[model samples]
Target: MPNITGFLFLLLLLATEGSLGNSKNEVSHGSSQNVVGRPLGNSLNAWKYCQLGWSTYERRCFRFFKTALQWIYAEAECLRYGGNLASVHSANEYAFLKKLIHQGAGSAVKTWIGGHDAVKEGIWLWSDGSYMNFRAWNSGDNQPDNYKKNEHCLEMNHGAVQLWNDSPCYELKPFICVKK
Candidate 1:
């Protein structure tokens, strides 16, 4: 019943978001009267568009899931939200994602961020079909070494500050999702 109610409310918000300005805060899914957003006149900006549990950055909405899952399952979960795993394109964006993970997980954690070379070795691509222009690979020990010939998916916070390492797609790790 709660899921239905939340879905209806989300639909209503979507239908009226343009006219109602935009929601800027997390929305409660239950019968709480303390809702914050455009309708409640709590928006700090008139154009924010990310929903509850998602953080808006530069017109894109990002969500971090703490539940550990394999890379494929993580991407699938993101796809369920009409998006794919996040793709970091710049140092600032990567820092922002790291901050989001820190806030959500309470520490640095090995998390999935959608860079993979599953199809072709030595060629990485974002799962969202975006170009792979930036990389924060771990320089120590020479990562993405394809240890055991199974490392293909990208993960961050692996033994280095904000650095990434390649891991098997079957390994479980928390993930982040993004959408415009």
Candidate 2:
């Protein structure tokens, strides 16, 4: 029947398109030969903090800091390895970052996060040029707690459940950096 023939043709076309879509997804996920000409390392290895024993996933690198450093120094270190501190743009990403930090399993300390009110006081922005979407702050956080008026950098105090803290850019603290 001509109708049956046309239906089969349509089904075949749909199957082919599906296969193509899957191939593209695989390539994007770094499971295809499309990366042959690029560097030969897993996403974890390509991360900037691998030298510091941190891991990577899908072009993002993570690091755990036992000590604290100033924001500028932390940012410089991240730049040295082609990365900046981590920023969470979505709930899933926030969960993933929290998991990674939890894996480090160290004492609570204020660590530098990748956001600041640098451009204009009170206008926060991530180093990656993304807008501030979600903020995790503790009580009395971000209130300009009796410091100079020019403190522009942000930190996450683990003791406060990774709440935000604004501090001078030169204060030293251990920070996590992300690379892509």
Candidate 3:
């Protein structure tokens, strides 16, 4: 009889904990709420990827371009696909991209992101001309240092642990694109 009561109590606790976890996830991943019914891909299968590649925590579809290109070219390529260069908004999104890049292109690989200060020095902006409020700049004493006064494009995963670095916009490098 006592064993039955203990088992019932354990079950109740488990259910309560599960509910709490789900609630927290929902609140944390509010962007995914609208993606519940979206199809992963089209019927033709022409696109290389589908909705499954989107991170639920970030609420954006990401694609990595293995080819290296200048910042302007990279941004143009992304725009052709109805998206812009990948703009990371949160730490979770950054971490997700870091892992994804490592899995897709190997670690220590530098990839062009959407951040740039081309318009004016010291004022960073995303590809869509949005102000950059979130930052994961490398504090390694040489990053965003604008070495030689020509570094304006933002590159991630340049150093260990996916830190952001400023590089010349003309430098060719692999890039990631993001679509809504």
- Per-prediction TM-score to the true structure, in the order listed: 0.75, 0.60, 0.68
Q: How high is the CA lDDT of each candidate model?
A: 0.84, 0.66, 0.78
Report how far residue 175 has shifted in candidate 3, in Å: 0.4
Candidate 1: give the clashing pairs: none
* Prediction 3 TM-score vs. true: 0.68
Cα-based lDDT at residue 153, candidate 1: 98
Q: After superposition, how far is residue 150 of candidate 2 from its true place, in Å?
A: 3.5
By summed lDDT, the worst window of 10 consecutive residues in model 3 runs over 41-50
- For residue 171, model 3's alpha carbon misses the true position, in angstroms, by 1.0
Residues 93-153, model 2: lDDT tens digits: 6655666666665544567889888888878889867678987655554344425786788
For model 3, residues 1-180, the per-residue Cα lDDT tens digits are 999999999999999878965442233334443323232334432223224444433335787888899999999999987789998888877888887777778765899999998888878889976567689998874678889999999999876656999999999999988887
lDDT of candidate 1 vs native? 0.84
Residues 1-180 of candidate 1: C-alpha lDDT, one tens digit per residue: 999999999999888866544334545454323333422124545444456677877657799999999999999999988789999999988989999999999998999989999999989999999998888888785987988999999998889556999999999999999977
The TM-score of predicted model 2 comes to 0.60
